[model samples]
Target chain A: MHTFADPLRYASRMAPTKTAVIDGNESIDFAELHRRCRLLAGGLLALGLDKGDRVAILASNGQR
Target chain B: MGVPAAGLVVVPLNTRHAVTELKYALEDSQTKVLLIDRDPGELADCVNHVILIPDAYDAMLSAAQERELGVDVRESDLAGLFYTGGTTGKSRGVMLSHRNLIANAFHYMTTVPQREDDLMLVMAPLFHAAGSNGVIANISGHWEPRSHWPRSIPRSHSI
Candidate 1:
């Protein structure tokens, strides 16, 4: 029953303060990462996106 | 991450491909929204909604309220449509479900092993699966020590 998001979910709850992603100038913890992902999910949902819809990501590295 | 987290499918387009190929992929995949990093130029019109990565993306996130993620998605549901390089012929959208990707992540982590503190550097583009290979294991807290690798890498990578 695992999904790609399961890892993030587990890490955020298990090690909320641990650094999960380190960008160029800053680093974010799992809790912060989880919060952001949730917010981003909310934002997309507010945009009228629905389940099973396709969302394409076109970008170079370090943009996320 | 957000798209799939929201129960939506993500289609990562290869930046190296021609605009025509990209357009073809978008159309073929039936993508509804495009979250891009820079000025989309002609690609702006490809999808119904185009959200700029840093600027508009941040704005959207800032205005966003937390919501339940993956409430309707299942392990077997499609998570992403990875476009092939089309070296032989035309590019194809490879359907990958959430379970498939999770399993793949586990496989990758098992093969190479990863430490909780290891800072991975993605040598390939994020559009490729290789770029996001380390993301799951890192988050999953699987430990495998190479012992001799550097702690930091040049440039930057995002998961």
Candidate 2:
């Protein structure tokens, strides 16, 4: 039953304020990172995108 | 990350590929949405929606509400379509399920147990499977914060 999002949810609950991801000087806490992910997910859904839809992310690894 | 998190399949296009190759991958994958970090040129026309990173990307995130979609995502569901190097012919899309990726992360973690304080620097282009999979493995196992080292590592080190 464990999905990709489960670990973040668990980590956020376990340590919400802990730094979950960092890229250079920018750092996001577990709770904030989880919230942003949800927001991004929501944004994609708002665009009429649903499950099984193809999304291509072209970017280098960074805070963005 | 947002793609799969939204229960959608991701196609990480290799930036190094020629424009024609990029176009072929997009067309073959039937990508609905394309999020590019830079100008995609004629390739943008291939997808239904193309969002330029930073500017349009930030706007999209800001405009949308912060909520999690309630979707039943199965492990067997296709999570990504990774294209292989077209050494013999045109690159082919490799269908990978959520279980496939998760299993890989677990396997990677078992091989290299990550510590919470360890810092992982992603130098490799994420479009490649190894790069993305390594990042996934690190994050899934431990919340090891990423660091961007300005100085490149010596050539003696392969990684």
- Per-model TM values vs. the true structure: 0.89, 0.87
A1-64, model 1: which lDDT tens digit per residue? 5565666676678788987777788889888988998998888888898799889998887737
lDDT of 1 by residue, B1-159 (tens): 667877899999888888999999999988889988877888877789999888898999999999877686788999999999998999999999887776666666556755556788766777888876556555654422233122332223447
| Winning model by lDDT | 1
lDDT of 2 by residue, A1-64 (tens): 5456765666677778987678878898878877887888888888898688888877776655
* Candidate 1 docking class: medium
lDDT value, residue A5 of candidate 2: 71
Q: Highest TM-score: which candidate?
A: 1
Error of 2 at B151 (Å): 40
Per-candidate fnat, comma-separated: 0.82, 0.66
